[model samples]
Target: MEDFALEHINDSRRTILITAQLADSWNDRIKEIAPDFTIELRPWAKAADIPDELWENVEILFTLGAFPTPEQAPNLRWVQLYSAGANQAFTGPLAKSNAIITTASGVHAVNIAEYVLTTMLTWFHRYHQFGSWKQEGHWPDEHGRDLFMPEELRGKTLNVVGYGSIGREVARLAKSFGMRIIAMEQRPDHRDRGFLFPDIGDPEGKLPDHYYTKDQFQQALAESDVVVAAVPLTPDTRGMFDATAFHAMKESALFINIARGDVCKEPDLIKALKEKEIAGAALDVFADEPLPDSSPFFGLPNVIMSPHISGMTPHYNDRVAMIFTENLRRYLKGEPLYNTVNKERGY
Candidate 1:
């Protein structure tokens, strides 16, 4: 595809490139909103498969990970990323460009929030130990048996770091379980600016009992029984949870991270777990994916680790298409787009 590069191919018209999987299903929707656009539904697994010549007129791009540099697609006006997090797009070659970037932000909010709640309850109920008993077909004796422990979700404080769509949904559900909310935000505001599913999240931001900024993070950490880190992966957030941060939390606080792994320092977290710096944890994302077989998190008894699947759902593309189609409609009307990444804030 590199060999197909052109010195100059000018086109004063907008073009849309749909390289994401299930492109065929969304083509009509794209055409509906962008009838004037030169639509190209070329489903590709890698950027190299896309010919360079196609970039000349490409103003809109929708893809999973595939991307062309500024030079390759200089006419690019808007980029619709398949994933909710715009971290990769902001950090990649397009970082310097003026192209408008939007994300599938609200798509995974519901599923990820549910996953966080599941992990929290799993730890609270100690069901993992019961799994061992069921596997051996053995019943626990009365000495350690208390099936109805009455340990329910009530009056517990949940500190949510980075109050975005996922955090908002989590706050909404945790509230339903009678948990008080404490939010620690980067800018410390209740107003949600991203794409939202109707009636699904804390849209008005009235859920939080108290809102804390990053400067007061340690204090917020100490007050919570559970901490959910759902902040986007950015320069300010990467490795933000180090030894000092973990130590600031109450020793009994349950750490739940459905956000990017790099947000927490892996080795420090392992040490904290081993030393009982915190009660336990449920980690979906990780600093290293496939979580390296040699990683200490795998051996830690108190840690609930998954292969970074908290955001997955059967309706992923369906929801993504909602945000994309709506954005397309707005684009046609020259209205402000949804979930546009903040160049300064880096989300």
Candidate 2:
């Protein structure tokens, strides 16, 4: 076998296989990074039409929107996922394959953190309801009396459920606004590390006073003024936030879910909001994409909903492309990749 050298691999005119649609800018960026490499764009045709010849010669397989079964690409060595979440692709044959899988993780962190803050501010300031009030010509006495019902984020405790890239960014931004941050993760080793808030200059090394395991999540919820769910949707996380968990939150506490929709039980959340178990919620992702017209969340005054776009921004594609390109360089160099998911732990 030939020794795989980073420079040599990139210089060999190797064919790079892209498995789904690539934005024009992203495609151009990839070419800029690996000018010597041949780019092969393979849009999602039927599974039967995936060319075996292309797979045989390709050195890297870039998966955008869909994943190929391991059997479909026997010669594949590396699989770079375009999205942050790899749940849809990490299964069956691909799970067992020798291919090195990497995801676009940290790329969306800043954008998502901004989204969380925007939603939180909107709810706290009552912007949504105010818009409705303006449209209905129903000005309340408070509106004319120069009174505003605004909630303060300062001095509030924000509990982040998963301290991954996105969670880290959210914590940093929250800290900037004078909010105390708490984080919980499954791994006990990361409890005091405070890697999540390091970006905000460490803030005098003030680590979360309360670090809880999955078993202690209820206790975390009880003290949290705001609970932000950034956990991925794994077998353990799916439908994890049900009635019981919601009921554990303080009656005045707010909930924010920027994680997968399935991680929360929609019906249970509705019940919690209706019964005043929680003050309010801001949901970016939902169990169903483009939530059905009949979904109760649309009609709920206490909930703020977005179409699963907390991580979206105008520059998102460019950032994703840059991360993927850098990781490709790392892969060729045999260097450690950032944000590598634990397949067994499922992120």
Candidate 3:
């Protein structure tokens, strides 16, 4: 097989579809990399809104949110997603399609990891308690100290479930606080997975004191002060944190879910919190978006919730562009793309 590369593009201009409106500067950047390619901009308002003819000849696609089937785009060869977690897009009929799929996996690691550390610090320092005191216009300095003593992250065991890009970033930050790390991953033996992003995550697999596989989930849960959920939402991970899983954790352990909400069953989490099975929880993503007004999580004093925006960053689009542009070059040459998804595993 002649390995694909830029030379294979030939003189004919190839069609590339971008489903989002980008600055004109990006056009120049793409041209600089592959001058023979022609770009088509189509902001993804609705998938069905796109004309049938537009999908007929698109060879490559850059999309933030939209999945067209192989039948819809006969000429489509590759898809570079603007978001992390392929989820529904990677599964279903598309999984069997000829088109290759890639995700923006490591792009959110830096921001999401920072959010995790911020929540941890806030919990440790009892910042929420201080806010309450301020609201009540009461200041009992010594009484406050006695009521809510501050704890240090140092020397604490931080367990990171799903040691992928996000988990690795959490471990990297946790290490800076002098915390001991124990992470669980699907493949513990293949510890060093390369990433496209720079200055993020534990590439060397040196941060965690030990790494465990699925069989040791209970053991990992039992030996930590803080447990961070960074796994994707897959069949195996759905409702993974059930009653039995909650019972395996230390009573004083703090739980943080930066991963999908379905990973932890809502009922099990509620029961654990109400019964004090664990100390506290900080959640970024949930089973349902815009968590309903009637949800009990809103009233939990020990819980902190964000509207699934932990990964938001000003440079998000720029980073996505970089990943897509790099992969586009690889695609032209017929080389392996970065962040290529494993549809079977659902990462």
Candidate 4:
């Protein structure tokens, strides 16, 4: 088949295949941008639900789950991912395909950033202890000062391991609290362009006190009062936060992971927290989904575990639609797509 994107350069009619259910108004919203395009909406609960014929004609694929191979989608040209992380999508035939992949990287930044703040504030303000007191109907006269004193975020150092959309948003919010920020990214010199929501994060790159590359990651960890893992899962980043990285952190520093769970070895993190190598950790993602019921994280007092809900928000679908709309406009104009994943980097 001729390159579908190139073939559609002057054509207004195209085919968009989406897995997730969309409201009638949202469908209209998409049609408003590309009125001539035909859309096929399916539940996409299973990968095999999409028939070979459906894959053969789809020019654009919009989905959260179910990654179809290039062999299956012969006419596929672009993939608009509903998820921020593209680790799962970049596997098997999809990794080597000629189709362009764009992520909703900035879409979830707001909610994830808020989750990070909530996790940190919950620890610093001793909300967990207060909740326990409320449950027991016991009011402490000293406000649990002896047991837990409130710590302010002001003047504290925040080291963001990945300076992407989520990390930048975290830094933006942290800066408002008077916290100092440092960040590590694969390329500090490269600035992210083509974002529709510039107010959502540090688009100007002024939030971080310093920027460090991978070589200086350990140095970034050692100086932080709070360490946040917001990088993608790649060959170089898988198990990046091992025992050595954890041990390099300040004994009193708290760790927050809003990125992929596999970024840090679960056993290594458990050992670090158990040994008090790091003060505590709040994890939103895990190495395994529905993190096994027998997992020790459920019972750990110093650990705050959530079921991968950091990126969740009431407006998620709407935000995603906006990203898709912008990318669609670019696609019609034959412009470079936003959040284009570098296959070699695996982001």
- Candidate 1 regions exceeding 4 Å error are 1-13, 23-25, 146-150, 187-189
Q: For candidate 1, lDDT tens digit of each residue in 188-268?
A: 457777787788888778999999988898888888899999998999999998999899998988899998999999889
Where model 4 places Cα greater than 4 Å from the true spot, the runs are 1-13, 140-144
Q: What are the TM-scores, per candidate, against the unseen true structure?
A: 0.93, 0.85, 0.93, 0.92
Clash pairs, model 3 backbone: 4-333, 5-333
The better-scoring model by TM-score among 2 and 4 is 4
- Provide the lowest-lDDT 10-residue window in model 3: 1-10
Count of steric clashes across candidates, in order: 0, 0, 2, 0
Candidate scoring better on lDDT of 2 and 4: 4
Model 2 — TM-score against the truth? 0.85
Tens-digit lDDT track of model 2 for 63-170: 664445666665567777778887844665567776667777766777888888898788777786788778979777854634347888888999989877777778
Looking at model 4, how many pairs of residues clash? 0
lDDT of 2: 0.75
